[model samples]
Target: MRESPIDDFWVRARAAVPTLPAAVPEAWAFGATATDADALLSLVLDGTKTGTASSLHDCEADGDALPEPGQLSVILDGSDLPRAVIMTTAVEIVPFDQVSAEHAYSEGEGDRTLGAWRAIHESFWREYSQDPRGFSADMPIVCERF
Candidate 1:
């Protein structure tokens, strides 16, 4: 038997900013860099705040479990002196429990809908069909800067 490779991916968005106050947790600084999705991925894997020297790739992924978007940001602080701020929102792509990857794909690339419910449904369903029991097409996830 062979284990099929699971492509579990999520996109995190962040607003670009310079420095965030040290009092604020690095996890919440995601809003400072919400457009750059890669930063969030780094945060997910390695969340230790390195104070200008830290990077997310440094973290260890012990298992294949996924990170909770809101929860994920809170667990880590990025490397920055006083911490360079990161405005981030995350989208995680995991192996479908029922829906196959062939069916789901991201809908909004350049188009912005101002976060209407219809827009949210379109985004999730456009990339992938609804999970019904888990993530549904009716409700949408809204990300913001911390």
Candidate 2:
């Protein structure tokens, strides 16, 4: 089985994340022909898992250091699906951390809100809301447009 680019990226990002308590080894593959942005997040929200190969538009930043606006990384374990893909991107972590701290006893989307996790995802919800460049004590990021 071949590893997807996203998978490869994560192998590297993992080093930065450090070993945490809750970590799920994930892999993703990218098709340059794949659509741009965290469009994958929308697909997942609609309960879609199958991904299509499309032209990949480069994000605003460059290099593996992570872009200011943030770059989307991915992983792919080509064990079964030839088009296997997974995407991970940046989001507001501080607000999420705060919400999690106060609402240890809450319900609903709070279970997976923007401030709920640093889990694997690609949506720049901040682009649509007021949480642009939001950061946590662990992950600090500059606020730039995607």
Candidate 3:
């Protein structure tokens, strides 16, 4: 059987970090599209992006477990190649409209303002969200700080 890139990446990452678990964590990219993934990943690699948000409805629908503090994740690029490993420092569930400006700033997108964050996320979710629930002002958002 051919070894996946993620498996190979995990081997290298564990070698460097040394403290990572023997089992690899989940690997994922940032956004719906390759372009979006690359752009968002750039922010993360540059240390400008420390936070991210996801639709709780989507997670539930997909049967994915909620993120928790101390969880490790492998970040993939637009091409689905692992680039970096991140540790979840915090996770909060909040209404979409209630997401804090501090969290918005940590996302490091657009003008780094709540308004920008809302606009960007709203549009992205509306267009790309897998869940039919889509975008809503009061929708539950999983805000994660890593």
Best model number under TM-score: 3
> Which runs in model 1 stand beyond 4 Å of their true positions?
1-24, 28-36, 39-109, 114-132, 143-146
- Encode model 1's per-residue lDDT on 1-146: one tens digit a residue: 54211111111122232332223333333312334234543543453312111111111222222233343233323432122333333433322232222222222222222233244334434454323333443332332222
> Against the true structure, candidate 2 has what lDDT?
0.32
Model 3 residue 38 distance off true place after TM-score fit, in angstroms = 0.7
Q: How big is the positional error of residue 126 in model 1, measured in Å on the Cα after superposition? A: 8.9
Each prediction's RMSD over C-alphas, in Å, is 15.6, 16.0, 1.0
lDDT of 2 by residue, 63-126 (tens): 2232222233233322322222233332232233233422222112224443543332123332
Assess candidate 1 and give its lDDT.
0.29
lDDT, model 3: 0.95
Model 3, 35-67: lDDT tens digits are 988999999999999999999998988899999
TM-score-wise, the better of 2 and 3 is: 3
